[model samples]
Structure formats: C-alpha cells, structure tokens
Target: MKLKSFAIFGTFLCTSRVTLAKSAVLDQTSLIYEFPNNTWVENIAARNNGELLLSIVGTPQLFTIDPSAPSPRQPVLIHEFTDSLDVFGIAEYQTDRFAVLTGNFSFETGDLGLGSWAVWSVDLNGVKISIVNEEPTLSSTPKVAKIADIPPAQILDGLSLLSQKQQTLLIGDLSAGVIYRLDIESGDVATVLNETFTAAVPIPHFAPSGVGGLHVRNGELFFSNVGQQKLFKVPIDEDGTPSGPVTVVASGLSTLDGYDDFTFDCAGNIFVTTGGGNSIEMICRW
Candidate 1:
C-alpha cells in the first residue's frame, strides 16, 4: 500500500485513497492503530521493514508499531528521552538510521523553551524487536546518539534529509520562519531560506508557528506554512540552497485548523495532516 494515502489523527492511524472527482473522496479507510486519549503523537516515520516510528509530544516517547499487525495491537516502546519534555519531528536519514528532534514544548501555551532543543540519531542497525503476538524481545536495543544541541531554535517542527552523501539534514523552524540546514557530521546549523511565505501570523496570546511540515522530493524542497495554510516547493541545490523561486502547490487548507505534517506519494499526491482538525486532506497533482 502507498504510505502517501495514510494519515494519523490524535492517536489513530488511518489510510484512504484519493480519487479523481469533482469533490475529493476518501475510500478504503481503515484504522491501523489507536493510542489512548490525549496521547499527542507529533510525527511519524517508516522503517525499512514497514514498521512505523511514532514521536509523541506529551509523553515525550518514541514508539514502533507494525501496521500489518492484527487490529488493536499495542505499540512497542523504542526509546524514551527522559530529559526532554516533547518529541516533534522525525526523518529517516539513512537506511535504518532516523533523526529525531526533541525539546521542551508547552501544548497549552504553544511555547517552546528556548535553548532546550537537540537532535538525536536512532540507529536500528541489526536489531530485532517483535512488534506483535507476545512481549517484545530486544536482543539489542537500537543505538541512540545525540547529534547536536540546538540552543537558538524556538519551534523546530519538521526534519528532512537534505543529502545523504553530505550527511546533512534540513530542519523547519516554525517560530523563526526559515529552513535550517544542519550538518550531522559537523554539528553546524545555517539558515537556507527566509521569506514572507514562511512568516507566521501574529496573534495575541498565542505562540505563532509558520513552517510546519517539510520534505525534499524531485530535487525540490516541499514545505508547508501552517499559519498560512499553504504548501509550496522550491528547487534546491545539493547543499540545501534554493535554486529557484518558491511555487505554491496548495492553499487555503482551512477547515477550522492549520496544517501540520505531510507526505508525498509516488504519483505526486500530497497528504497533509491537520493538527486539531482531526482530518487528513489530500491534494492530487495530475
């Protein structure tokens, strides 16, 4: 099944295909898994063997779940960051190596603790952990490595692999409204893009967030402005620098909430998750 047709709302995971019609319709919908109430799952990443890595904000834990498992299977605990208050973005940099973002965040106030963010590397190299049936037996737990501490980032929401050979990752800073390039090998961070398209709307008594979701595809950097409810893409070089102007892919996604995380399909369809809206919206590019 194509992962682009899947979306997770709250703690429940569901899949639906978008067909060509006057109005978009979701078909083949099924719930893969569901967590307890208020278990805010922030981000998700897929493993090579089809297991899913879930990042939770409130619990500040990382979990692995098997989508192909029988209904109502419990997700296995991968690793929990004890010191962090929240886990936000996750991206598979290499084959089984995932880069995860963790920090202190306030769900009630929408505030991120300054100077309290870090990047981590979760390497699942040669490790076997059972997902279904009985209790999970971890012969060897996955290696967890701290890559770097990001002190200046306010709201780092999205992570994407910029270059595998360069060992770099692209991070979306929601508060800063810029895309940052992080050198995993050197622990260096640089702003690659800063424009009005990424700026958040100023609202009183609320922590504004702009850039939310990010992905690199077809030599272009695709990102979402959550505050603006727009999706855009721009051609970029190998070093994560913009090579062309930003072009809007979709807009006005407002349905009582803003956009959060998203993914692209092989057929060029974009699937977006609405944070509080409890719905998944799809944009088909024919």
Candidate 2:
C-alpha cells in the first residue's frame, strides 16, 4: 500500500514555488493514479518502457499507467480516437509509435471550433477499450494519417517531437500565440515563435490563453505561459530557426497559476501542470 491518493473529480487547486540549482529541499508528495471522475486529464507522457500516457479531455480516450504495476496503480485503456477526435499533445513517435494532436472539440461545446485540427500517427496497438457507448467500436483502427491542418487562428495546443529524421513537428498555438514548425514529411507549416502571452485571469469564463508547456532541451526551446505566469527559453538554429531573444527560464514563481503541460524527469526534474491550479508541480535541480 504505497500508492498514496488518486481520485479524479475536480477541485484540487495547488500552487508551488521553489527554484534552486545547488540547494534543494522541495518534497511535495502526492502520487496517485486511477482516473475517471468524468475524466479530463489532458497530456502526460512517459514511456521508454515504463508506460504512462494519459490524454483524456472530453473523450476519445487514451490512458495508460503501469509503473511496473503491482503496488496499486492500474490505469489502462490505451488509445482510442475518432469520434471526430479529441486527443492532445502526445509525443514519442518511433518505437511503438505515438504522435497525436487532434481537435474537433465539442464534448458538447467546450468549444474549439473554426477549423478542426489534426496531426496523427498513433499505434500503441490502437484503440484498446473504453469507448463506453455513443458509438465507436473499432474494426481496423490505428494507422491514422492526417499530418497537418491548423488554421482557424490556431488552437492546437502543445506537441513536440522535432525530428523523427526530419519529419519535424513543434506546434503550440494556444489561440494564436504562435509557435509552429510542422513539416511532417511535407505539410510545411512555419511560424517558429510569436511570443505567447495573453492575460485576463479572474476565472469564471473567458478562456483560450496562450502557449502552455512545450519542451526541447539541449538545443533549448522550453516554453510556458498561462497568461504569462512565465517560463521561457529560446535559441535553436540548425535550420529549425528561432535564434535569439526570449529568455526568462521561470519567473515570479508563486503557485504558478494556470500553466498547463510540462514534463521532464530522468533526474532533470521539472514537472509542471496547472489547470487553474489543479496542480502537479515539481521542479528539482541539485
């Protein structure tokens, strides 16, 4: 019984702040897993063999967790999209494949209209289960191929994986705050960075902010900005252009309000996910 707590039904606003390079001491713990409270867990990937992929917002599911399973974490349901699609920002397109980013949005009007978006290539064995009624039974799925088409003023949230040998991809346009560079073998989309930032946060209604979590280390290109709660880093020139200006790797940290999506761990540690503060925050370096 070392699994902690895992429930999933909304109401979990968390906020944290701690930055250090050589002096560490931030151990906020809460490790739970077992989704489905009307499920809404968009984006989270980690699988070199450890397994853990989750992106469930509205439906067209995709959930999996197998932390070497046995202790109490079972969260299976692996892949299932095409009810008009609704998966979002998933990466890892090589072994067992996975590079999704769909959006037709309308789980009854969570509204993401103007031009349904796409960019798929999933096949982790394709639609496994969890499509409980309302149609979608699968017959020969998973080999989806749509590639690119995001222009309704952009709302294709995050998706990184810049080169499966030049297939290229790095889209992140949370409502036109721009950061595109998709070339998925020739769909050609480019707009490197438009500098995401869109304020107004009193929360009640009025959403569609800008750029939220997108990574690409070593060549630098980290971003975040739920209405500028801040966290940026630029410099990437080898042809995928984006050289100079845009630095502020983490700023004014204090609860990190609504910045969604971010993951990195292998000891590098930096886990950020803040949907109006439903938290998943961790930043360790030391």
Candidate 3:
C-alpha cells in the first residue's frame, strides 16, 4: 500500500524539493494489476512483446498482461466497444501497427457525444490499415486507411513511443494538460508539452489530472503530474527533438489517485499504476 501512503491533499502547491510519503517501495517481482471492471485505468502501453497494455474506463475493453506468459495472462479483451465508443489511446506502433484513440467526447462535448478524435492503425488481424484522424466505424475487415479529421479533441489519454531516433508519437492531453506529437509514419501532429501541474505542496489545487503516460526510458521521456504530484525527466535530442528543460525526478505525489500510467526498468526502476489507490507503485534509484 505504498503510494506515498495514499490520501493526501496538502494543498498541492507546486515545486519545492518534495518529501511526504507513507508507502512507496514495492517489488513483488514488481507487478500489480487491478483495473479491470474496478474501472479507471486510463492508459498504459508496452507490447513489442514485453506485454502489459491497458486502457480501461467504464468498460469498452482492451486489456492484456502477459508478464512472460508462464502465468500472468487473465487480462485480455483486446478492444471491444460499440455504442458511442470511447477508447482513449493505446500504443504499439510498427511491425503491423497498433495505435488508437477513438472518441465520442468526454473531457468536454455536448449533445449525444460521438465527438471523434482519431489516429488509427490496426492489423494483428484486426485489420484497419492506415486510418488517420477520422473515419472508423469498427473496421475489422476492409483494411481501413488514410482518413483525416481532427479537433473537438477531448481525450487521448497518453501514448508514447518516441525515440528510435524519434519515431515520434507521444500524446497525452487529459483535457488541456497537453502533450502532443505524432508521425506514426506520417500522420503529422504537434505540440510537445503544455502545462498543468499544481501541487505546490499544501496550497495549489488542480494539477493531477494530466501530464499522463508517455514512458520512454533510456533515451529519456517519462511524464506524470497527476495533479502535480510531479514526475518528469524529458531529454531526447539527437534529433529526436525535445531539446531542454524538464528534470524533476519526483515530487510530493499528492493524493495518488488513478494516477494514470508509467513504465521503466533496465536498472532505473519506476513502475506506476494506481487507479486512484488500487495498487502498483514502485520507484527506485536512491
């Protein structure tokens, strides 16, 4: 139960040094998952076979956990949502493509919803070839391709895979806390990072709703601000284009709710997940 010891709201000010915890240091082989129907799992991706990808919220479906397969599988729904659908972000782009962001609007949208905001691709047999921007009504067959239409954007709750010398594709804009960049083979989109990280430390307010998931360790690119509990380390510029400023490491970690996504390990350690206090929080490098 270490997520800095759960429940906190010390104002949420903003930057200061940081230190206020009750729990944080877990390593049960460092794996935890509980965001199936318990709702609010937002986004998480890593499936070049490393397996562990999810995006859950009020059902629709798309969850997989193959911690090596020997026995950690019971979380496979893949992608299933019909009526007024919503599948905010999921990644695994290349070698057949898999990057989604279906929207009907929420984070803001009026009448009947269905406010689409797409950037697609699908072919692990799900077929839907190159669908970009708009146009997608559950392909699964025609192979789908090149369709553009964006704006009225609501949620694209995080997706990261930028650094293979900048293959570019990093999106997470939990309603304006912004961070966009896309080029998954040239669908073209921009806006690297925005702002919204309050939690100063016992006074600031909003902050922790964004700066969502976008893990890219080793070449650097990790984000979190779940309302300013803060955690950034962006640095990728050999042409990967993200040149300068951003290196907070970690901060007070306010209230720790369904804190969205994160991943990293190859000797740096950091694995976060807490649909607002369900579990999974392991940070290292002391």
**What lDDT score goes with residue 11 in model 2?**
20
State, as a TM-score between 0 and 1, how close model 1 is to the true structure.
0.88
Off by over 4 Å in 2: 1-35, 38-40, 44-134, 144-158, 161-165, 169-212, 215-222, 225-229, 233-235, 238-242, 249-258, 262-273, 276-286
The predicted structure with the larger lDDT, 1 or 2, is 1
User: Mind giving the per-residue lDDT tens digits that candidate 3 earns over 45-112?
Assistant: 55565555565544455555555543222455555655424566676656645676666553233322
Residue range with the least summed lDDT across 10 consecutive positions in model 3: 4-13
Question: Model 1: residues >4 Å from true position, as ranges?
Answer: 1-25, 131-133, 203-206, 255-257
Alpha-carbon TM-score of each model against the true structure: 0.88, 0.31, 0.28
Q: Write the per-residue lDDT of candidate 1 for residues 84-171, one digit (tens) a residue.
A: 8889899988889999999887766666778888999999878655633566545478999999998889888899999998999999
Error of 3 at 93 (Å): 20
Tens digits of per-residue lDDT for model 2, 1-286: 0012235322212433444422233355345565544556777776666566777655667766655444445576555666545677888757757777777665455576557777777766534323235332333455656777766434576888776777687877666667778887677787877743422233224355677668777787787776666666687874456777777665434543656577666656576765655555566543
Top model by lDDT, which number?
A: 1
How high is the CA lDDT of each candidate model? 0.79, 0.62, 0.53
TM-score, candidate number 3: 0.28
Segments of candidate 3 deviating more than 4 angstroms = 1-17, 23-37, 41-86, 89-100, 103-157, 160-212, 215-220, 223-234, 238-286
